[model samples]
Target: MRKITLSNGDTVEVECLSCALTSGLIESDGGVVIETDYLHAHQAVAYRIE
Candidate 1:
């Protein structure tokens, strides 16, 4: 896990990029496209893909 400081001066613990994106801890351009108990999917932008 990793800890990050937000612009609002709050701290959050994150597991990984996918977890963060799925949990709404971070924002994605297209947002979450699909979510399930065992799976999650979302549209990936150019920067994210890179």
Candidate 2:
């Protein structure tokens, strides 16, 4: 991951979520639910604002 500073002086970690998922850097729950020659869809239970 990489960190970037925003204009408000907030530094946040950055990463390519899509790339991570596809490349297996991040594992998707239940694996990929859908896929095609040009697309892929998977279940990702991530951060939740509740």
Clashing pairs in 1: none
Q: Each model's TM-score, in the order given?
A: 0.51, 0.53
Instruction: Note the clash tally of each candidate.
Output: 0, 0
Every model's Cα RMSD, please? 5.7, 7.5
Evaluated against the true structure, the overall lDDT of model 1 is 0.65
Off by over 4 Å in 1: 1-15, 45-50
Q: lDDT (0-100) at residue 32 of candidate 2? A: 91
lDDT of 1 by residue, 1-50 (tens): 87765444455677676667776868666677878998888775324343
CA shift at 15, candidate 2, in angstroms? 1.6
Report the alpha-carbon TM-score of model 1 versus the true structure. Answer: 0.51
Q: Rate the local accuracy (lDDT) of all candidates.
A: 0.65, 0.60
